[model samples]
Target: MTLRLVIFDVDGTLVDSQADILASMEAAFAEIGRPAPARTEVLGVVGLSLPGAIARLAGDESDDRLARMVEAYKTSYARLRHQNGAASSPLYDGIRPLLEALHARDDLLLGIATGKSRRGLEALLDTLDLRRFFVTAQCADDHPSKPHPSMLLTCLAETGIDAGRAVMIGDTSFDIDMARAARIRSVGVTWGYHPAPHLSGADRVVEDTAALGRVLDDLLELAT
Candidate 1:
């Protein structure tokens, strides 16, 4: 059996966090006495770091205001999670089963490469009881945000997995581009924030978890 690493993006890939994300964006902008960006605008930046996302939405804003918005967004997101518990961000359908099946494979290792901050990723993992499913988790705290290769490179370094033997699974172009930069294969999911058309660069684009599993099996050459 060959060892392979499977890296996942968190927000739109592993969990459906759109509601909390949009709500937090609204709260953050409200805290700064600014109107929130449109829902489509917010969702468009779903796979970037909070700072990057906010910067894109609030173009040309002062650095101080951007910092404040980031802090306010964090506060609002934490509060929402506390108030709603796991319900604030639930795993997508069929995801848990797929994760369990993958985690059980002796030749496979699971990891995370997300734009989420360390604190935010930890909270989600703990809430969903998903920490055990991954062997390594690389987040925004230590690396440049998505679309950069830092996170995936670090996952490869930590796991000693060859780039050829690893695959990145995500919903956004940021994820696909990151994997490409890292010289790894990518599997894009369409049921997340990004539409299917945006995932054209991916090695494979899956519509659901079942299709995702099959693509992974094919990409990683796993025995069926």
Candidate 2:
């Protein structure tokens, strides 16, 4: 009954930000006279840090040009934020219910560990009315990006929870990598940005919401 923390990723695992992400990315590419990658290709890089994702999207461009593209992306993203970011964004089906179910568990504490800015995450959470589910969060702006484990460590620090008892639920190798680096258990979601096979490092992978709920239940069982 002492499973005190559950940290989640944002882009793919919670809110499906693909529409705005792709639109804004395309706007970035257009400024550089390049084309946006298809949705499938973009999904492959969705979980990366913004700079990292920009690097991949820059392809063979020179450093200076890539930097320009990044600047363009930032400007475009900001403009897009208020106007279109949430227009097509939505919480994954069952996320609210799942959070509600978990929130009712007195021993569990919900939080977020994501490569998004704290303001950006807060905006999305407010849009979806999902902020109440979290008691703590660590966003990319708070620390170095995934695979560094600093964000997760920060979550542990701020929440005063143990890494050994926390479960990191996310959708990409970066997420799993973070969990493993932090020595915490990871649960991968198959429906998100990364394929299940690529999430091999996770303690387990769940196919859907029902399965995810079951996985959480089992983890709590072990914790108790």
Candidate 3:
């Protein structure tokens, strides 16, 4: 069997950063003297790149205003991280075990495809001491926002894994659609911002991280 590459989205999938993300978003809007987007609205765009997500949240704001909000978001998010120290977003239950189990498998390769900037992604991975698990990492800095296949294709390229042998695991439709566009499989996780119904585009939807390994086992079998 060819090595199966599993690409994961970072924010809602691996780390439960919803609270911090929401706080930063609200702070950004406040900085611009604009009412913050509703929580559900913000959550809906969790998988998009910062600029794309901000553009959506800004609605009719001018380009300059949107840019300012983006900068504010970055500043606020960084400050929040600094304040929280190591107590930021906690890794989802079973994530470490899942990664270790997968890493133990010679037939599998792990990678990350996230809307997070490279700096943010690296900081989170390093803080969690998880930087060694992934063989490839793709970020918003390297590709277009989610729902585009660029990130997945880039991960496949970097890992020398064909789309047929790859699977994307995330919590949003953007992740599933990206995999679909790339002609690969996707597994949706339910414990994130988006509910399972919203993740119907995924090839399979698992209820939690504990079920992820089983789902991947099934995907790997089908891929071969």
Candidate 4:
């Protein structure tokens, strides 16, 4: 049995965090005394690090304002999580089962590569009782934002998995591009924030968890 590492993106991939994300973005802009970007605009940057996402959304703002907005967003997100608990960012349908099934495979190792800060990711995994599913987790705090390949490369290194034996599964172009840069295969999921068309670069594009499972089996050569 060959060892394989499967890395996942968090927001919009494993979990449906659009509501909280948009709410936090709105709060961040409000705290900076600026109007929030449109809903589409906010969702468009879901896979980027907070600072990078905010910078893109508020490109004209100074670095100070961007930093302030980032802090505000973090505060607001924490508050929302406290208020709504796990419901604030529920796992997408079939994700838990898919993860469990994958985790059961002795030859496979699960990991995370997300734009979330380490603290944020930890809190989320704890709240959702999902920390045990992953062997190694990579976050925005330790690397450059997605599309840079830093996170994926780190995940590969930490797991001691070769790029050819690993696959990145995510919902955004950033995820696919990052995997490409890292010389790894990728699966783009359509049920998340990015439209399916945007995922054309991925080696495989899946419409649902069922399709994703099939694709993963094929990509990783897992026994059915």
Q: Better model by lDDT, 2 or 4?
A: 4
lDDT by residue (tens digit), candidate 3, 1-224: 57999999988898888888999999879877988889989999999999999998888888888889898999988888778855677889899999999999999999999999998888888888999999999999989998999999999989888999999999998999999999999999998888779999898999877789899998999995
lDDT of each: 0.93, 0.82, 0.90, 0.93
Query: TM per model?
Result: 0.97, 0.92, 0.97, 0.97
Collision count for each candidate, in order: 0, 1, 0, 0
Residue pair clashes in candidate 2: 1-224
Q: How far is 94's C-alpha from truth in model 4 (Å)? A: 0.4
Worst 10 residues of 3 by lDDT: 80-89
Candidate 2 least-lDDT 10 residues: 80-89
Candidate 1 lDDT tens digits, 1-224: 67999999988898999999999999889877999999988999998888999999999989999999999999999999999999998999999999999999999999999888898889999999999999999998998888999999999999998999999999999999999999999999999998899999999999999999999999998322
Better of 1 and 3 by lDDT: 1
Flag regions of model 2 displaced more than 4 Å. 1-3, 84-86
Q: Rate residue 16 of model 2 by lDDT.
A: 82
CA shift of 206, model 2, Å:
0.9
Give me the overall lDDT of model 1: 0.93
